[model samples]
Target: MFNCNWGFMTGFGPGGGMGGFGFLFNLFIFGLLIFLAYKLIQRLSRPDGTRDREDSLEILKRKYANGEITTEEFSRMREILRS
Candidate 1:
């Protein structure tokens, strides 16, 4: 015999009745999301970001060897990369 009071039935319709427990649960979930995001970012960013640079340099070196770049350009690019 549950009489539904349509007035404030959902406590705040469409929003659901999360109340105190709801708020705490949401906060916990939000905190977990933030922590996970931080961890993911930390893992993605590293001093070994040099790998990408080296890979690009390798491509450039190959292009030079294939006679795609001028000698002067190759020397300049090599010097720039070494630094």
Candidate 2:
């Protein structure tokens, strides 16, 4: 014969004894945490906020310095960006 503490088990365990909302509430909280975690990870992975406006300007200057782009093209693009 198993000496089962049914009262305590039902009260704390997954016996749906602490009202039906307990398990559903815990599940909703868990899902919310997962959603927030996913959004945080996505936000951290992108370079949008991490990069500044000057980054592109610096890169364009480097390309001009390296002779990858002509001076006219560089000046035109730089003026366009500055405006």
In order, candidate lDDTs are 0.77, 0.76
Runs of candidate 2 exceeding 4 Å displacement: 1-17, 50-83
TM-scores, each model vs. reference: 0.42, 0.42
Number of clashes in every candidate structure? 0, 0
Worst 10 residues of 2 by lDDT: 6-15
Best by lDDT: 1
Cα distance off (Å), candidate 2, residue 72 = 14
In model 2, what lDDT does residue 10 have? 43
Cα lDDT of model 2 by residue, 24-77, tens digit:
666677799999999999988987634655787899999999999999999999
| Model 2 TM-score, 2 decimals | 0.42
Cα-lDDT of candidate 1: 0.77
lDDT by residue for model 1 (4-77), tens: 75532343334658666656666677799999999999878866658877987998899999999999998898
